[model samples]
Target: MARAPWEGDFPDVFVNCKWKSPDAKIICLADHGLYDAAKGQRDMDAALGLLDDIVLEKTVSKLRGLERQYGVKPKLIAPAAQVSESNNALAIGYANWLGHELGWPVDENIFQMKDFSKDKLNGWVRIAHRSTFYGEIDKKTPYVIVDDVITLGGTLADLRSFILGKGGRVIGMSTIASRDGNDVRIRLDTDTQAKLEKSYGSDLAKFCHELLGFDHRGFTDPEADRVLSCSGYVDLRKKIVRGRNEGDASRSKKQAAR
Candidate 1:
């Protein structure tokens, strides 16, 4: 598991923005080309780096529509934190292009403040080792988040939380692509929350606070669903604990190699 040089070597810091109501609108231009490519014989390298001018144009076009629909002009565009397998900040390229095309300034201040990588991890492991961000945000400005793709939306949720925590308002998010049937909304619904509480009882909140560094309400819809899918709270705890141990060992090995 290679880590980015810029990724910090510290504890994970989870931010609970309590994002609810008026779900943040997402403008996804296409389905994730990479995943689609993996299913058959297709090349998606250019798409991954936002090097395809057609895709870029399409993304910008949709963003324009979003602007008109929302009637809010974003002062800045910030890319969600994502370090690729080759140690590249993938979303930054897309964000820069979007900013240039949309006449918005690109904000690169928010970034990963931990040495965690999401590549090839299962859902539970990914949730256990969620990325943390650190930086200054312009509190007075309305912002838009940009990312190459949306999976479970944990990354974008964290980015939104960081901006909201810094007193900045994120008007919306624009992604190049998204998984089919995936909802962009991050807030867990009442029904889902009720189910989670029923399964885990009050221990759910304590578990989230102690392990993930947030209250249970901080969970995104997908994250809460994943948690609820566990057989029981003990099973969930064991999985998280094992994931954390594995992560710690990997980081330790990397440090020793350095």
Candidate 2:
């Protein structure tokens, strides 16, 4: 059998983005599944179709609702267009779709990523190399950053900080999914957090925050332990394999009963 695209050279998951504290203003249509599906299949058209059919209209509704609730009109910000890769292409398509629906001009090329590949660890989000956003981003204007997924949230954090530094305000962030859980709080209990903090020292705890938008409180004990042990990358493949095994076991049990 052919291996899934996610099972390629890099581990399917890794900590890349810095965390931005969870806020209520942001509206995500779906979770990270959209990103995975798009990248796995290497098909931007199908991904955009899913986003358009299942997520786009609803996303617009949510945006209108947010406008009504906050009285703060939001503009869309996305990573610059990179048509070569599947995920970047999806980002571009999403931005264009949302821009067209709302009649809001998208600052599509506001930020240009120096590196093409996303699998790198250290320079995943190079703030220093990022050129100043040439587009007109009115000061204090509320902007919502869009992405396919929010795993570690390092990229979003970097984007938020960059916008803020440039005199723009980031009211919220929207993405297809949250890597660990949809909620933006610490998932770990107090005792577990304390244990991991003591065992791994303060850096790991900081990493938990930098990688995800939440602090150490967001991780469960097992999750924290997994972070510590996965040294090179966040090994979500284990979770996937374990889930498959459980599913197979469940089917076997059911068949036996029959």
Candidate 3:
């Protein structure tokens, strides 16, 4: 399996992940822009100004690799942007860079609200950032799902379900960073957290401290952490497990196919 950059090179995950292709749809889950700790995320418009050619070149290389490994190249379509931003200039830059390099037209119109919730979504679900979006997703050909980070993949699950329901297929999912998660804490999602606690009587705090890196395992970003904490979604640890499990399953299927 193509291990993420942080996996320490145990073994690369070999899958049908096309890093190169002439035509493919690309979509960024969450805000595809970088998370700056200091200046914070510049609006998508500001992101355009920061995007140098070097970044574009490297991005092209990654996309080509994805296409070669999978089957198609992804023209970045849409991205989750900062709500404070005026426009999708950064997103447009990302899409156009991929489009021009890969010879595909980027679909700039494909997007959703800045953020989504379980109550707001219908059909399938995929985790974008730590949030969830439920609606039309990958339903036709293989599409590319991108995100700035893949912490636990809870958001990705929502994306997966939404895609399946829409009849679209995903060639592969890509992200800037996919932080590891905790398994014990994984049994602590909002849906299953209470059930497991009532059944197994596990202590959430002690478990996170012992097993996961921090008491709040789901959040790696300080700002995101604050956001999640404020939302009262105290069970972020399990999303990592669910995310990894889903990733494992997806890669396993690809491995089996190969």
TM-scores for all candidates: the values are: 0.70, 0.49, 0.41
Write the residue-wise lDDT of candidate 1 on 63-136 in tens digits: 67656866766754444443331244335655666676677778877776545455556666667776667778
Q: What is the lDDT of residue 152 in candidate 1?
A: 61
Tens digits of per-residue lDDT for model 3, 1-258: 110111111111111122222343432222223323212444544444333311434445656776787666544444444344323343345445446657855544344444322322221223322332333443444555544334444443334334544665544444432222111111124434333334334564455445333343232222233224422224444554454455445546655755
Error of 2 at 229 (Å): 7.6
Which residue runs of candidate 2 sit more than 4 Å off their true CA positions? Answer: 1-47, 56-59, 81-87, 119-136, 179-258
Count of residue pairs whose backbone atoms collide, per candidate: 0, 15, 40
- Model 3 poorest ten-residue lDDT run: 1-10
Candidate 1 to truth, TM: 0.70
Lowest summed-lDDT stretch of 10 residues in model 2? 1-10
Q: Which candidate leads in lDDT?
A: 1
* TM-score-sorted candidate list, best first: 1, 2, 3
Q: Name the better of 1 and 2 by TM-score.
A: 1
